[model samples]
Target: MRTSTFLMSIIVLVAIMCKNVVNGAIAEGGWMTYCQDKTKAPEGALFACFRSNDGGIHYNGRDLTSSVIYSNPSKANEIAVVLQGHGASAKFWTNDHTVQVYVKDGSSVNYSIKPRQGEGRVNSSVYSSSDADVVIGK
Candidate 1:
C-alpha cells in the first residue's frame, strides 16, 4: 500500500509538470533562442521569440514582430541574453515583460511589449559597465 501511494504521488507530480510545459507556464513571460554566432544573425539563425496575447502566444517570424532589429554592429562573436526575471539587474518588471540582449561593447538592446499592444514598455539605455550590469527589462 505504501509503494502504491508513492507511485501515485509521482504520477501526479509528472502530470502537473507536463501540463505546465504544454501550457507555457515555463514560458509565462517570454523566451528567446540566440544565435551562437552573432556575426551571422537573422540569417540561418535558429532564433525564436515569444509574446503572450489574449488571442494566444505569438512567436517571432510568426505572429509577433520585433521592432529592435538585432545586428552585430560591433562584430561581437557572442551575444548575451537576459530573460525578464532571470537577470541580475535592478529593474522594475512584471510577468511577460521583456528580453534583453547585451554585447561586450558596452551596448545593450531591449525587447518588450509594443506600446499599447500588451502590458509594458521597453526602456533601454547605456552606461558605464562599473555603474550598472548589462540589463534588459520592461
Candidate 2:
C-alpha cells in the first residue's frame, strides 16, 4: 500500500536524522557520545532498558567503570542531561510505557510503549544479567 510505504519511509528518515544528532561520531569514552549495542546485551545494563529512544545508547559499564563523566558513581557528581537523556528513569517513574528524551534545548520526543516483552537485538553490554549469566562480575 502506498500509505504504508510512505509511513515507513517517514519513520526511517526520522531515525536517520536523530542518529546524526546523537551519534555525532563520538567514539568509545567520548563525552556526549553515542554507541549502539546491536546484539545480545548483558543483563542489568541501564542501556539495555533504553533501546527505544532515538540516538540513545546505554552508557556501558566499561565507560561507567572509567568514570569518564565522574571519578566514580559515588565520587564526582556528573549529570548533565535533559529529560530525553533520562528516558529509562522516567519510564520507571511514570509507568506510561513510553520513552521520552529531552534535548539540551528542552526539545522532547516520545517513543511508543515497548511492552517490556519483545525480543530485539541490543548491545551485548545492555544488561547486567540476561537469563542465565551475570554480565557484570561482582
Candidate 3:
C-alpha cells in the first residue's frame, strides 16, 4: 500500500511539471510598437511589436487588408517572418530557425537580423500591397 501511494504521488508530480512546461511554451503577455516609418506604408497600414512571456518578440503588420506575422526567438539573434493573408492563421515554434512568409492575396516582405543583434536593432523591408512600403529600424 505504501509503495502504491508513493508511485501515485510521483505520477502526480510529474503531471504537474509537464503541465507547467506546456503552459510556458504558449505565447502570452506581449507589447506592441508601431512602425518607425508610416509614410511609406500603404493605405490603412498597421504594424506593431508584441513581446511574449517567453522573451520572444512578435512583429505583426497589416496593410490594405492583408497581415503578416514575424517572430524573434528568445535565445537567438535571428528573425523569422510568417506572412499570411486575411483570415489565415499560422503557428510558430520557439525552436524554429528558418525564415518563412506567406502571402495569398496582397503582398509580403522578408526580414533579416544581424548576428548577435538585440531586439531593439532590426532591419526589414515590409510591404503588404503594390503601394505599401514598410521599413523597420531602431
Candidate 4:
C-alpha cells in the first residue's frame, strides 16, 4: 500500500509539470534567430542578435517578443530587449550590432548591444497602440 501511494504521488507531480509547460507558464529558454550579422564591430568585436517567436512567455504572464544581442565567441556580454505582444520582426543594421524590432500590434523597439560588459539583462518597455515605435540603444 505504501509503494502504491508513492507511485501515485509521483504521477500527480509529473502531470502538474506537464500542464504548466503546455500552458506557457514555464519558460523553455528557447529562441529563434531572426538575424545574424557577421560583420565585425569596433575593436574587432563580433556580435550576434536574435529575436524571440510566439512561443515565448513574458514574466508578467503575457506573450513575449524580444531581441537578444550578445558578443560572439565568448558571449560574455549580452542584452535583451523585450516587449509584450505577438508577431515580431527584426531588422539589423549593416555591419553593426544595431537592430530594430517591429511588433505586429503596431509597436516597435530598437537596441544596440555592447561587448564584454557583463551578465545578460532584460530591459522591458511598455507601449500602447499609439506609441508606434520605441528606441532603447546601448
Candidate 5:
C-alpha cells in the first residue's frame, strides 16, 4: 500500500512539472502575444503575452475610437480603447487559428492570447476587407 501511494504521488508530481515546462516553452515561443481558442488548444497548454509600459489608447466605437483596437462581430467587451501605458497589442497564431491586431506605434504593440468560447473575431475601422492579414469577411 505504501509503495503504491508513493508511486501515485510521483506520477502526479511529474505531470505537474511537465506541464510547467510545456507552458514555458509555449510562452517563450510567442504564444503569450496572441489569442487562442481554448477548445482547440492542447490539454494543458496556456497562452501568455508581453506587456509594454509606453503609452496606449482607449477607444469606443463612436467618439472614442482613436488608436484603439477593434474586433469583428463587434462586441463592446472584446475591444481595447485604452491599453494603458503597456504595449500596443499581441497576437498568437495556432495550428488553424490566427488573430491579427493593428497598432498606432507598431513597435509598442504587445498582447497575449485570450481564451474564448465559440469562434472569435475582432472588428475595427482600420480593418480593411482587402487587407491580406484578415479572413473573417472573406
Candidate 6:
C-alpha cells in the first residue's frame, strides 16, 4: 500500500508538471530562440515584440516579423529591452527594443549574473534584460 501510494504521488506530480508545461503555466512569459551568429540566424532573424495600450510607453516585441527584426516577447506585458551598443545609448526606447546584450568577464554564471557584478569588459559594459538575461555560455 505504501509503495502504491508513493507511485501514485509521483504520477500525480508528473502529470501536474506536464500539464503546466503544455498549458504555458510553466512558461508564463513566452519562449524565444535567438541565434548569436547572424550568419546562422534562421533566414530572416525574425522574432516578436509586445506592448500595453493602457500603460505609458510599455512595449515589448510580441512576435517575429521580418529580417533584421526579431519580435521577441516577455513575461510581463511591458518588457522593454535596451541593447546599449545596439542603440544610440543617448536614450532607451521604452517600447522599442527587444533584448539588450551586455559584455563582461568570463566568470559569469549560466542563468544568473550575480558573480560577475561590478565587472566590466575591456571594450564595453555589462547589460541585461531584467532577469531574462542571455550570456555567452563558454
Question: Per-candidate TM vs. native?
Answer: 0.21, 0.24, 0.25, 0.22, 0.24, 0.20
Please write out the lDDT profile of model 4 over residues 1-138, one tens digit for every residue: 999999999999999997874434212232221122222122211112343321221222232244333222323222233333245433433222333444544343433332123345444444332232233233
The deviation in Å at residue 58 for candidate 1 is 17
Write the residue-wise lDDT of candidate 2 on 1-138 in tens digits. 999999999999999998875543222332122122223322212221232222222343332321222112231222211122332222221222222222222222222334233444322222221222211111
TM-score of candidate 5 on Cα atoms, chains taken together: 0.24
Write candidate 5's Cα lDDT for 1-138 as tens digits.
Answer: 999999999999999998896464333212212332323323332222212222221233443212233332223223222232223333433333333343444223323232224365543334221222222222
RMSD, model 1, all Cα superposed? 15.8
* Candidate 2 wrong stretches, greater than 4 Å: 25-138
How badly does each model clash, as a count of residue pairs? 0, 17, 3, 0, 28, 18
Q: Score candidate 3 by TM-score against the native.
A: 0.25
Candidate ordering by lDDT (highest first): 3, 4, 5, 1, 6, 2
Candidate 1 lDDT, 1-138, residue by residue in tens: 999999999999999997875443122222222333233223222222222222222224322222222223243212222322222222222234433333222233333333333655554453321222232232
Per-residue lDDT of model 6, residues 1-138, tens digit only: 999999999999999997864443112222343322223223322222223233223323432111122233433433322221222211112232222322123221111112123343322233322233232212
Select the stronger candidate by TM-score from 1 and 2.
2
Q: Which candidate achieves the best TM-score against the true structure?
A: 3
Report the C-alpha lDDT of model 3 over 2-24, residue by residue, as the tens digit: 99999999999999998875444
What are the lDDT scores of the predictions, listed in order? 0.33, 0.29, 0.36, 0.35, 0.34, 0.30
- Using lDDT as the measure, which candidate wins? 3
